[model samples]
Target: MPRLNAGDATRREAAGHGPDFLEALARGLAVLQAFGPERRQMTLAEAARAVDLPRATVRRALHTLVTLGHLESDGRLFRLTPRVLRLAAGYLGANGLSSILQPRCEQLSAQFGAPCSAAVLDGPEIVFIAYGQPARLLNLTTMVGLRLPAFCTALGRVLLAGLPEAEMEALLQRHPPHAVTAQTELDPLRIRRRIARARSEGFALVDQEAEQGFRSLAVPLRRHDGRVVAALNIGMHSERGTAAALREAVLPTLRAQAADLACQFL
Candidate 1:
């Protein structure tokens, strides 16, 4: 994926509600978010380039974060401190969705001997909030807070199918789909159709599109009022079955779990 740039930041700032927007705070959070698995540490110049902000601006943000104990620097290279995880902890603690879904996901994983997960849509990606996997399955790397492309994963497609047409179109335009594997569908029209099918069918199934050897089936987790708040999915190796067979086997169980969860939502 391309690094977030100054243009993206500028557009976000512009999109923000006028006077109440704190540009400094936004910049600081942006700088913190720029750090990820691929970028664990960076010098001031490297940090600036990653966020595409000026060195001075990024320097101030870095120093502020360091002062707050969220980041640590060893004279030259800066990296996130363990304190940064408190932010994620606060969210996970406040949000009851993960707590409610985790046990059910674990049950599903145990029943099917595969990985089960729950995620919510965020911009062009779906952020995993809860996950469960069989002990023997070591090939899949899913975990809480993992982000995957929204256009490619079964969970993402289910969530995307819940979006309003205009919002979905805008999101598609902003972040055009890219191929993650040879089986990934890159055509926007086809992707939209797949999402539509998910909406109509109340489930989505993908065969080795997001990953080479795994297939997933997903269903939307909706509120009591019918608003989709997240998605639930179970993933297994491609060798387990064909996509149609997988759906026939697991879709009912996935939908039942989703419905059970929905009743708990407001």
Candidate 2:
């Protein structure tokens, strides 16, 4: 089979995209995603390398993004401008999840005296969309738009548990579980079993998996139609307590809030 270029309309169409699949738009978005908090400023060569696109292709995409005010270039280096934040703002503003969940997450954070977050699965990773914070200084960095591997995070596990078995297996294959810390689970079969258990039990708990000192507990946030659309989680230091203790602390309140929000989706 030939490799399908994500930016090639003919390639995408031949691979199953219809006329409605705008390859140029997809390519442009791909280019935008190449720039993150770390890759703030990048030259054309760096951008090409980051997105695995040809220099010419990246050039066109960069030019298009700059023309649309999503990016700005200073001579040789290109970087995302403040306009990019507007894109995230639009999603948070338009989605009812932010308004409804932010308050609830804030309440949870206050109750637990830690950071609370809501995230949704994005292929092999989970992207935090909403967050709440308490007065305590914490090391968890799951701010909005942050992405972490699905196989290693409590948020990701709960969200993945909501997926169908075939979809979950495919994503796990793509991501391939890794042991981030000594406690991280690396076996794919065991990971699958854990996700299955989370689906049955309606929550997931991971300790020192993605971060060295972090412990996380997550539950699914379902839509009114009973589809799990997101994961809500609380983060604390590993010094806090065991997973069972954390589960006992917040499980009831988390489950209650999730259930209440499920009926209030817009």
Model 1 per-residue lDDT tens digits across residues 1-266:
34447886676668875545666798899999999899999999999999999999999999999999999999899999989889888987888898898898889999999999999999999999999988787565559999999999999999999999899889999999898999999998999999999999999999899999999999999999999999999998999888888998999999888888888976
1-266: candidate 2 lDDT, tens digit per residue: 35446576567666797757766688899999988878988999999999898899899999999999999998799988889989888998988778788888878898899889999888998998888888665456648898888888989988999988898888788777777788888988888888888899999988888989888899999988989988899988878887788889988888988988888875
- Which run of 10 residues does model 1 get worst, by summed lDDT? 1-10
For all predicted structures, in order, the TM-scores are 0.93, 0.91
lDDT of 2 at 114: 85
Give lDDT for model 1: 0.91
Off by over 4 Å in 1: 1-16, 138-142
Task: Note the residue pairs that clash in candidate 2.
Answer: none
- What are the per-model numbers of colliding residue pairs? 0, 0
- RMSD per candidate (Å) reads 4.8, 3.6
Q: Determine the backbone clash count of candidate 2.
A: 0
Output the lDDT of residue 118, model 2: 93
